[model samples]
Target: MSESKSAGEIRLIRLDRIEVLNPRDRGSRVFDEIVRNIKAIGLKKPICVTPRFDANGAEKYLLICGEGRLKAYQALGEEEIPALVVEVTDEDAFIMSLAENIARRQHHPLELLSGIRQLVDKGYTFKSIAEKTGLAQSYVKEICNLLRSGEERLIVAVERGAIPINVAVTIAGAGDNDKAVQAALQGAYESGALRGRQLVLARRVIDKRQRLGRAAGRPSTTKHSQVSTTTVIRTYQDEVKRQTALVRKAAFSQQKLLLVVGALRQLLSDENFVNLLRAESLTTMPKYLAERVWPNGSHV
Candidate 1:
C-alpha cells in the first residue's frame, strides 16, 4: 500500500486550479470589499485547501477555506497564489472550514449559527463543534437555542440579512413569527419607516412585552390609517393642553415650596441664622445661605 499523506506533507497549489466545494453568494458588499483590499494590498493570506482523490486514485486539490478570496483572486485574474493542501477526513475538513470561517475579522452571527448547525446536523455535537471550530460550547448552545424558539422563517430572514440576528432571536423567542413578519412586511411594504434601527426597536419592544406577559403589538397606540385633519388638530391640541397642565402643576408646586421656605427663613431670627452659619464649616456664602435658609427635615 502507498504511504498515506498527512496534513503536514500536503503541497502548495495554484489559485485557479482548485475547485470550490461550497460557495457563498448572498452579499455583494463583502465581495466588493475583498476585491478592493486585494487590489490595494495583494494576496497576503493563502487559501486553505484539501486534496481530492479520484476513483482511479489520482490526486486533485479542492478549496476548503478562503472561498471568497479564491473567487476574488479569480475575478482579479491572478495567475497563482499560495495555498495549503491538507490531507483530511470529511470530519476534519468540516472542522477546518468552521475554524477558518470563525477566525474571520467580521462574522455574521446568523452565518456562524448556520455553519455550526450544519456541522451538528452532520452528527457532530455542540461539544465537538466547539472543539473543532475553536468556539466555546456555551456559545454553541446559545445559538442553537434560537432554532428551538420555533421561528424558522425569521431565522432564515436573519441569515439572509433581511432582519438583524439580535432582533430575529427575540422574535423567535416570542413564538409569533406570523405577527412579527406581518408587522415588518407591512411597515416596509406600506409605511416609509422601514429602517434597520426601527426594526431593532420593534423587536426590542416585542421581546420586552412578551417577557412581561403583555400584548406585543404595534409599539405606538395610534394606527397609520389616515384620519381627518380636524381630528389630528384636535388630538394635537389635547396633547399640548395635557402637557401644559402637567408643567403648570409642577411649577406651582415648586413655587409653593419656595414661598414656604422664604416665610420660614423670615420667621427665623437674624441672630439664629448667623449663629447656625457660624456652627457649620461652609466655605462659600451661597452654601452657608442655602444651609441657613432651609428648615431641617420639615415638610414645606
Candidate 2:
C-alpha cells in the first residue's frame, strides 16, 4: 500500500489484502471477455478501494468497485493488482460503488440489482440513489421496492430485458385478479408497447397457463407413440387445405347473397313488384335479409 499518497491516488495493492464490499455474480461470458481484455492489453482502469485495518492492526482494503478487473487479475495468476485508493466513509463507499456499477456499459442485470440493494440496505433514500446513479428517482424507488418485497421474478424479468419494467410493476400490483392483468395488457397495447401479434400470443399463453395450471410444458405421463415430423407436417397441411376451402366457399356464398340482396332491394323499390309480393302473401323475410333489402323501412 502507498502510505504517503492522498485520496484518489492510483497504486498497487495485494489481492489478498483487498475485500470486495459489494461482490456481484458477474455473468460468465462477460467475465471471460473481461479476462481476455485484461490479459491482452492489461487493465485500462484500476480497481477502487478504501483502506482499513483488520483486528490485528494489519492494513487491508475494502473494494469499492472494479470487481471484474480484480478477479481477472487473480485468474491470470497475478498476486497484486493496481487500485485507486480513496478515503471515504462507509456510506460514501457504497454510493461510489453504485455509481461505478451504473457507469459500466456491459454489466449483468443482477449485478445492477446487487449494487442498488447494497445502497438501499445502507439506508440511502431513493433520491440519493438516483442522484448518484443518474437514474430517475421513480425508477430507483420502484426497483428498490421490488427488491424489498421479494419480487425476485419480476425484478429479474425487468432487469434482464425479458419484460418491460412498467409491465412488471403492473403485474406486481395485479395480485390474484385476472382482470387487472388483462387491463395491464390493454394499457400496454394502447401505449404501443405490445403489438397485435404479441398481444394475441400473450393472451394464448395466459389462457393456456390458467387452464393447464403451469408455466412450462412437462413430459406427458399418458403419451402414445411419438409423433413423427412428417406426420405432423401432413396433418398441418391437411388442416390448412380444409381452412382454405371453407374460406373460398364462404366468399362465394357472400357474393351470391350480395347479388340476391341487391335484386330484392331493386324489386322492392318498384310499387308494382311490391304489390304482387303482398298480394301473394310472400311478404315476410329474415330480419337480417330484410335489413339489407329495406334498411330504413320494415319489409313485411
Candidate 3:
C-alpha cells in the first residue's frame, strides 16, 4: 500500500522479491549491532528499493540501500519488510547504493576497496571513481593497485590503522626480499610516515611475515612465535633512543627560547633600540616574548 508521493510511501514488500544490489562483507561487530538494534528498536529507516518487471510480468524490488537492515529482518524470520520504492535506472540505483555506504563516516575500508573494485569492474576509471565516490584519485589508484597485486596483509594493516597507506604501498612494491622490506620500513620511519608504537608494530608485522617467507602478496600460513628476550631488549633500546632524542630536541628548543627572551628583554630596555623598533613599526612582539618581557602588564 502507498501513502504519500513526496516521502516515498513505505510499502510492505515480500522479502524474497527485494534483491540486495551492493552487499558488503561487514565485520561481525557491525552485523551484531545491526541485529541488536533492529531487534530492540525495530527498523528505524525503511530500505530503499526500485521496481523491475520480470520476464513473467511480475514486479520485483531491487534494494538500493539498507542491506544490513534487510539482513537483520531476514534473521528475524521476517516475511515482508518495509521499503520505499524509488523510480531510478539500474545504474542510478547502483550509484545511490555506493554513495549511501561511502558517505558514512564509519564505513569500513574493506567495503570501500570492494566498492572501488566493483566500480572498476563496471568500466569506471580512476578519475570516474574519484568523481562518483568523492575519494581522492590517488587513493583510488593506490587501493586498486593493492587489490590488483593481492596485498591482503597490507590491506588488513591499513584497515586496522597499523600502517599508513603510502607505507603499505611502499612495502608491497618492495619485492620478496627481507632487505628490501627492511629498507622500506626504514624509509617510512625516516619520512615520519610511521612513528612510535605504529612503527614498532609495522616492523613486527613485516619481520614476522618475512622470516616466515610470507611477504605482503603471499598467502599467510605462518604462526607467530613468542617474543624473544633479544627482540624485547632491542625494542626497549629503540624506545629509549627515541625518547632521548625527543628530550634533547626539547632542551635545545627551550635554550633557544630563553636566549631569544633574554635578547629581546635587553633590547627593549635600551631607549635607542625601543625608539628604533617603534619607528620601524616593529613594536609588536611575539605573545610568548611579550608575556615574559611585560609580565607585570607594563607597556614596552
Candidate 4:
C-alpha cells in the first residue's frame, strides 16, 4: 500500500478488494477464449492495480488494467489472484486503463468508438483523444460523427471490412433515396474509390440492405428473397470478371515461368555454369523446374 512500492513486485490480493475502473466491451467469442485459456494454463499476466486508503483507513486497490482476466478468475470462483500494485493517482489509473484498451490490436472497433465517446463526454477534445489513442484526428472525428448519427449498421460493416469507410460515408449521406445511393455508388466507382469486385460487392450489400427495408431505418420482420433476374445477371457478370482476372494472372505467371525455365535450361548446359553451381553446393534443382526441365528424369 506504500506509494514507493514497485509494480514489478507481484502480490496475491483478494478479488473483492480490487475494483475494475474501465471495462472493455468484449464479444462472447473473446470472453469464452479468455475463460478457456485461463482454465487451461492459469493466468498468464497479473492484473495491475493501485492502492488507496478507504474511509475506515483500510487499503482498497483500484484496478488499472486486466478487466477480462479478473472476470475470468471471478467466473472460475477464485478468491485471491495475482496483482501488480503500482503507485499512481486516480487520473493516472484511468488513463492507463484507456491506453491499454486502445493499444490492444484485438480490441473491437465498436469498443474503441465507445471509449472515444466516453473520453469526449469526460471533457476530452478530439485532438486529445487522437494524441492519447494514437489515432488520426480525422479518423476519430469521422467515427464520432458516425456515433452521433446512430449509424450502427454502417459502423459494423466498416469495422468488419465488408465496406470501405468512404463507401459507407457516401451511402450514409444518400439517406433514404435509392436512386441517389445508386448515383453515389457510380460516382465512387468513377472516382476510383471502389474497383472491380469491391464495387460489385458494395452494390450487392446496399441492394440487399435496401430490399430488406433496413437501409431506411425501417424494422421489418419479413425476410426478402434475393433471387431476381437482375441479381442473377449481376452475379454472372461478377463471376465472369473474376474468372477473367484470374485467367490473366495465370497467363502472366505461365509466361514468367517459361522465361525462367528457358534461362535455367540454357545455363544448365554450360559446363562452367554447372561447375559454379557445384562449387556453390547448389546441385539440387527446384522441384517445379526439375519436373519441367527433366520430364524423362535424365540429369542435365
Candidate 5:
C-alpha cells in the first residue's frame, strides 16, 4: 500500500458518519477490559477510517481498523472520536483490518479460527494463510479441515475453552469412530492435558455430539409428522397385502418348478431319453440343473 493509504490526517468524525464495513463480535470480558483501559488512561491511539461517499454524495467514513477502540469510545458516550482518515480502497481496507487482527499477539481461539477461515474464503491457500498469520501450514490446514467438516461441537467447545485445539483436532481426526475418539479423550485426560471438569465437559460434549450430531446454534426441535395412526396402519396393511401377493406368487412358482423338476427327473431316468440327448450333443447341463435333476447321482 502507498503512504497515502497508510497515513492520514487526524480528524474528529461523528459516530453516525462512521459505518462499520465488517463488524466482528468481541468477547464481553475483552470489550469490558478495553472500555476500562480507555476510560482510565484515555484514548491512546486514533481509529483508522477511509473516506466513503453515499448515494447522496454525502461524506462518510468507512471503518478500516480499531473496531474495539471505536466501540469503547461509543461506550464512553463520546460524540466525536478522533479518526485517521486514510485513502485506501475498500478491499485494501478490509485486508488491512484482517492484517491488523492477524498481527495481534493474543487472539482468542474463536477469533483466530474466524480469521483463518476469512482468509481461506478470500482465496488464500493454506501456505499463504500460514505465512499471513505467522502460523504453521499444517495447523492452518487442520483449522480449515475443522471448518470444512462442520465440526461445530468441537469448535464451540474449543471456543468456550472446554478443550484445547490439539485435542479437538485429535478427536476430529478419529473420524466417525466413536471408540478412537473415546481413546483420544482418555489419553488427553490421563496425560493431564485435561483435568477434572474439563475432562468431564469434553466427555459430555462428545457424547452429546455423538447422540445429537453437530449443531450450529439451537438444537432442532422438529416434531413427528402429523400423519394419523389410522393412516399409518392402512399404509402398513397395504404393504403387507402387496408382500403377501408376492409370497403367494413365489410359492406358486416354486410348486410349478418342482413339477417341472419331477418331470425332468422322470425323463432323465429313462435310458431312451438319455440316449436321444447324447445324440443331439445336449448331454451337459448347468451344475444347478444337474444337481436338481440327479440329487443322489455323482454329477460332479
Candidate 6:
C-alpha cells in the first residue's frame, strides 16, 4: 500500500481491495444503473475506505462505503477509483459502514438494517446509532423495525427491490406472522392483504379458513335438505311471475280508483249538480232518489 502525507495512513488503493461490510448489498439492478450512469456521465462521488493490516507489516484497505459504485466500476473494468483512507476501530468500522450508507443512500432496506444491526450488536444504542450516522431517532427506530421483520422472504424482497421500505415497515408490524412469512417468500401478499384498513379483514379470512377446517369433520345435515339446481331455478321463476302479476293488478286497481275520485270531484264542483241537490233537499228530491224511497207511490 502507498503511504501518503501521514506515514501510518495509506492514501490510495485498488478498487478491488475494499470489501463490502453488509451481506445484503448485492445490488444487481443498482449496480447496472450505476454502470449505465458511468457509461453516460462517469463517476461523480468517490468511495470511502479504511485502513487495515496484512501479515508481514504490510498495509491494506477495507471498503467502508460505495459498494454499489464499486461493483459498477468493477463491471466496467476500471483501473482506479477515488477513496478516503482512515484508521478506525472495529466498532467505528461498523458505524462507518452504516454512516457511509446513510450518507450515500446506497444500501437497500435489509442492507441498511444489517449494517445497523452490526453496529447495534457492537453495543450501539438507537441514540448512538443516530448520532454516528447523523440520522434522526425516528429513522433509527424505523431501521431497527425493518431489521426485526424476521421474515427471510421479506428481507429478500427488500434486497431484491420488490417492495418499498415504508410498506415493508408496515408489513413488519402487522399481525398474522405466517402470512407475513408467506408475503416475504412470495415477494407479495394475496389479494386484499395490503389494502388500507383491510388488515383486520385479512385476518378474518384466515379465521374463516381455520373455522372451515374445524367444521370439515362434522356430517352435513344440509345434504338431504339440498334442492336440485333445476328445481330451484323453476321455483324462483314462478315466484317472480306471481309477484309481477300482483304488481300489474295493483297498478290497474290504483288507476280505476284515481278515475272514480276524479269524477266525484268534478260533479261536486258543477253548478247544475249543486242546484239539483239544493232543490231535492227542500222536499223536492231527485226523481231517481224519490222512486227508490217510495217504490210503489212514485214513478219519478
- How do the predictions measure up, each by TM-score? 0.50, 0.60, 0.61, 0.59, 0.60, 0.46
TM-score quality measure for candidate 1: 0.50
lDDT of 2 by residue, 1-300 (tens): 112334588889999999988776665677899999999999998999999999999999999999989999999999999999988777677667777887577655666677788777777789977878887899888888767655555565566555567776776577546788789878888987767666665565444333332223222333374789996996686677667757977999999999999998888889999899999999899887888887787674
lDDT by residue for model 4 (15-63), tens: 9898788865565677889999999999999999999988999999999
lDDT of each: 0.61, 0.75, 0.79, 0.77, 0.79, 0.58
Q: Give the runs in model 5 whose Cα sits over 4 Å from its true position.
A: 1-4, 27-32, 102-108, 156-166, 187-198, 216-300
TM-score of 5: 0.60
- Candidate 6 residue-wise lDDT at 150: 48
In candidate 3, stretches whose alpha carbon ends up further than 4 angstroms from where it belongs are: 1-9, 208-300
Scored by Cα lDDT, where does model 1 land?
0.61
Best by TM-score: 3
Could you tell me the TM-score of candidate 3?
0.61
lDDT of 6 by residue, 55-121 (tens): 7666667776777777788889986777766666655565666676755454444455556777777
Best of the two (1, 6) by TM-score: 1
Cα error, residue 137 of model 3, in Å, equals: 2.3
Mark the regions of model 1 whose C-alpha exceeds 4 Å error after superposition.
1-12, 55-58, 152-174, 177-300
Question: Higher lDDT: candidate 3 or 5?
Answer: 5
Q: Which has the better lDDT: candidate 1, or candidate 4? A: 4
Clashes in model 5: which pairs? none
lDDT score for residue 137 of model 6: 81
Between candidates 1 and 3, the one scoring higher on TM-score is 3
Q: Kindly give the stretch of ten consecutive residues in candidate 4 with the minimal lDDT sum.
A: 212-221
User: Where's the lowest-lDDT run of ten residues in candidate 2?
Assistant: 212-221
Which segments of model 6 are wrong by more than 4 Å?
A: 1-12, 102-106, 142-300
